[model samples]
Target chain A: MKLHTYFRSSASYRVRIALQLKGLPYEYLPVHLVRGEHKAPAYASHVGDALVPSLETDDGHWLTQSMAIMEYLDETHAAHPLLPADALGRAHVRALAQMVACEIHPLNNLRVLKYLVHELKVSDEAKTGWYAHWARSGLEAFERQLALLDAERKAGGLPPSVFCWGDVPGMAECCLVPQVFNAQRFAVNLDGLPRLMEVVERCNAMPAFQSAHPSACPDAQ
Target chain B: MKLHTYFRSSASYRVRIALQLKGLPYEYLPVHLVRGEHKAPAYASHVGDALVPSLETDDGHWLTQSMAIMEYLDETHAAHPLLPADALGRAHVRALAQMVACEIHPLNNLRVLKYLVHELKVSDEAKTGWYAHWARSGLEAFERQLALLDAERKAGGLPPSVFCWGDVPGMAECCLVPQVFNAQRFAVNLDGLPRLMEVVERCNAMPAFQSAHPSACPDAQ
Candidate 1:
């Protein structure tokens, strides 16, 4: 297997964490987004969305989108599952993951930031401001979700989750770690998201997550 | 089941299509985004994200995020599966869905547009241009993905997909149709993407999609 990744891309960071969590070894193929390698014709032709973090499966299929790729990994390699076994639990975990994937990451990705500057003609300060705003607000929502989940668990006679959903740092943790990395990179004020930040602390202490951090990636400058 | 939705929201529309496809009965509970009903104290307290298209299940849990809710419905109901049975096929379908859900829809939603106008002080024309730009480029990506899938299918000795994946309008179609609806509403250029537009046309011809259209919603303005 091969992963087409950019070290600094939070999306790529997500797939990296998933791969590490599954104890799967794959060649890391870097696509340098900052240098516009992702836009090169060969890469663009190969990847429809021309995005980083596309996993090339053993059968030679290139899977795009971090969420889909992560789910694919979880399904094929069931040990150390990224999602829970039950339907409702899966829903809860997936919603937490999407809170980061769909809400926070999309707004602050490279192309969107470039659009604000080169296309929309926003200032650099404004671009950073946009990044922080989405990150802060989205994490607030995530914290609120954790609280809701805690209350639900108490009602169901289950203990509170040590990670996003449970003690294991599953799917939601995979997503939250990367987004928090990006947030800290941009100096986003992550002041109010205690439960989410707590999960990040627990995830960061794990070797899988520590090794998957962008600084540890081969392409990291 | 009850769905908290706003008629014009593409995300809400995705869930509605899934429910209708599964033949599941759900009461429509409207959350008017334009008038700011989603941000109300009561609604916000009930829903962590305070976003529409949340499903209040039979046991009274509020499930959020269209993708998660749709998958939960598929898992629990199992009669009309929104995803393909095989893992790889499911990845293909989900990648298609996220191309809209993650890439396109998030950037052009109501809040993002409001940020562009009120926060960034962009003119209305720029905001519309922003909408059309992401919509058009994102559809181009969708079309490219379909072509790639076609090639992969041929390699696997399978027939060309009639809908997004196969003859059935499953999860990808559930997402694609509403996105196309919003694209058309914003008058985004649909000239180049024949495959995607074809899927939209076929989906529109179905009773499930027809009844789920925003115009068919109780809160359609």
Candidate 2:
């Protein structure tokens, strides 16, 4: 397997963590996002979408979209599953993931940021403000969700655990760490998110999460 | 089950179609997006993310994110499955879905549109151009994928199918309809996508799809 990835892409980072967690050995084919490599004719011909973290399977099947690619990997190699076994639990995990993937991350992506500066002619300060606004607002909602889960557990509605769903750090944690990282980058306050912060700290200590950090990758500045 | 939805929200429309297709009866608790009812204290108290299309089950479980909600409904009510039984097929369907959900829809969403107009102060013409650009580019990619599938079938690589996968629309068509609707709204060209257009036409002919349309909803202008 080979992954077309940009080191600093949060979506790519999520896939890397999933690969590491599953103990999958794959070649990393770096596509430098900063250099417009993702939009290059050669790479775009294969993926068609011109998006990074496109995984080419051993059988020559190319997969795009970080969440889709991650789910594909989880389904194909189920040793350490990223989703829970049951239906409701899986839904909760996915909802947590999408809260970041769809609602937050897309708004703050490199392309969108570039559009703000180049196309919209927004000042750097305004662009950064936009980034921080989303980071703070999105993460606050996530923090509330975590609190709700805890409260539900206290009221015997959900099971008590260290992770988002239960014992293991599944898709939710995979998404959470990246958003938290982005939050820290934007200097968003983490004051009322102790539980979320604790989970991030725990996940970051793991080798899978540690190895997937943007700064640890070869392509990072 | 009850769905907390904004009628014009593409995400909400996806889930509404899924529910209708599955023959499930769901009460629509309309949250007016234009009036900012989604952010009302009452609604926001229940929803952690303050996003629409929150599905509340008889069991009192609230499901957020249209994709996650659709998957949950598919899992619990197995009469009409929204995803393929096999992992590879599921991956293919999901990748197609995310091509719209993650890539196209996010860029043209209400918030993004508002950002373009209010924050960036882009002229209506330029904003329309931006919308058309993403819609056209995204549909072009979708058309290419469909064409690739057609070629594969001719070469005996894949079986002939009425829908994106086989038989049912699955994840791909769920996303495709709204996108095509938006594309047409922006007057994006549809010359090269006969297969996609055919699929869209077939889907629109269905009662479920028709009833779930933006115009059929209570909040439609």
Candidate 3:
């Protein structure tokens, strides 16, 4: 297996965590997005979308979309599952994941940030403000989501844990870690988001999550 | 099941089609996004994320995120499955679906558009340009993705079909229709993309897609 990755790409970082969690060994083929290497003909021919984190499976199937890639790994590997066994639990985890993947990261990706500075010509203050806007609101909503889950668990007389769902770090953590990394990078004031911050801290302590951090990546500057 | 929906929301439209396709009868509880009903105190209390297209399941669980909700419906009500049976096929379907759901819809949604126009004070022309920019490139990538699939299937001696993955109109179609609608609404020229438009047209011909359209909704103003 091979993964096309960029060290600082949150989406790529997500796939790395999933690979580590599943214990799937893959050769990391770095595609430097900052150098426009992703758009280069060599890389573009392999992954038509020109996106980082396209995983080429052992059977030689190339997959794009980080969430889809993560799910694929889980389905194939099956040792440590990313999603829960039951339907409803899977929905719960997926919803938490999408709250970050869809609502948060899409707005703050490198291309969108570049657009704000280049095409829109927004001030440095406003550019960072946009990042802070999505990060703060997204983290707040995420914290509230955890609170809602905690409330449900309390009502059901279940004990709380460090992970987002049940006793494991799964899909939500794959999403949560990178997002919190971005949040801190932009100095988003996550002061009141204790639950969210706690989950990030817990996931960061785990070897799978720790090894996938941007600073630990081979391409990290 | 009862769906909290905004008529013109692409995300909402995706779930509406999923419900209709599965033959699930649900009361359409309209949330007027234009009127800020999704962010209303009442709605926020029920759905912590305060997003539309949340499905209150038969067991009274509120599901947010259209992709998550659709997957839940697929898992619980298995009369008609949205994803492919095999692991690789499921991954393919999900990747196609996420290509649109994650990449295109998030950028052009109401709140982001509002932020671009109201907060950033971008010109009306630039706002529309932003919409077309993501839509055009996204749709083009989608078409290329389908083309990539076609190439693979051809190599495997598999026959072609109208939908993204196979013979059925499933997850990808659910996402594709809404995105094409948005593209056309924003006046993006989709002429060169034949394969994508054909799928959209085929999906439109189906009663499920037709009934879930924005105009069919009670609050479509």
Candidate 4:
């Protein structure tokens, strides 16, 4: 398998962490989003929209979108399953993952940031404000979710683990690592989100997440 | 079962259509997003983030995110399965679904639009421009995906159907209808997307899609 990725791309970071967690090795092919390498025809053919972190399977089929690609990897590999064994648990994990993917990260991604500066002609200060607004609000919601989950577990007399679900890191970890990285980059206030930041620290300490960090990627400048 | 939803929410519309497709009866409880009813303590207690289209199961679990809620419904009530049985096919269906859910819909949702105008103080012309830019670019990518799928099917000597996956409408259809409705409302110029529009037309002719449309909601006015 091969993955087309970019060093600073959050979505690309998500797929890398998932691959690492599953103990799956794939050739890393960098798609330079900053340099417009993704717009090349060869890459565009592989990923219809020229999105990064597209996985080309051994059988030659390509998959796009980090969540969908992660799900595909989980389905085909199935060793260290990213989702839970049961239906309800899977829904909870998915909901947590989407909170990061859909609500927070999408609004503050590279393209949207660039759009604020260039297309909308917003000043850098205001651009940063926009970033912090979405990031902080989204993380507040995430913090609430973690609190709710912990309360439920405590109510059932179950001990809490460092990971989002049980003792194993899964889809939510894949999402949280990249998001926390982005949050710190823009200096989004992390003071109110102690629980979420703790999970982020736990995830980053793992060898899998350490290896998948953007600084460790071949395309890191 | 009860669904917390708003009349014009694209995400809410997706789950409603899924429930209709599965032939399940669910009581609709309107959460007026514009009126800030989602932030009410009771509603917020049920959904941590106060997002709409939250499904309360008969067993008392509240599921959030349209995709996750739909998956839960599909898992618990399995008469009309939304995803394909095979892993690869399921991956394809999910990729298409996320193209709408993750890419297009997030940028144009009511909150984001409100942010663009109220917070950024963007001129109406530029705000509309921002909306069109993201919506059109995302849809173009989606159209390219459909074309690729069609080419692959033809190469495999498989016949094409009116729906995204096959003869039946499923998750992708749930996402596509709402997106197309919003596109037409914004005058995003759907002329270039004949294949997607054709699928949209076919889906709208179905009772499930028709009944789940925004106009059919009790608080649609």
Candidate with maximal lDDT = 1
Alpha-carbon deviation at B149 in model 2, angstroms = 3.9
Candidates in order: C-alpha RMSD to true structure: 0.8, 2.0, 1.1, 1.2
The sequence of per-residue lDDT tens digits that candidate 2 reaches over residues B23-101 is 9998989998888998988888777888888999897877788999988999899887889897767877888888888
Q: B107-177 in candidate 3: lDDT tens per residue? A: 99889999998889999999988898888898888888889888877777788866887899889999999
What is the lDDT for A66 in model 1? 94
lDDT on C-alpha atoms for all candidate structures: 0.92, 0.84, 0.88, 0.87
Residue pairs with backbone overlap in model 4: none
DockQ of 1: 0.87
Ranking 1 against 3 by DockQ, winner: 1
Write model 4 residue lDDT over B38-65, tens digit each, in one string. 9989899767678988988887778888
Candidate 4 residue spans exceeding 4 A from truth: A156-158
- All candidates in order of DockQ, best leading: 1, 4, 3, 2
Q: For candidate 1, what's the TM-score of chain A, rounded to 2 decimals?
A: 0.98
Report the lDDT tens digits of candidate 3 across residue range A1-221: 99999999998989899999888888989999989999998877766578888988787888888999988888888888999898977998999999999999999999999989998899999999899998888888888888887876677677885588788989989999999998888888989988888888888889999889999989899
Identify the candidate with maximal TM-score.
1
- Looking at chain B only, the TM-scores across the models are 0.98, 0.95, 0.97, 0.97
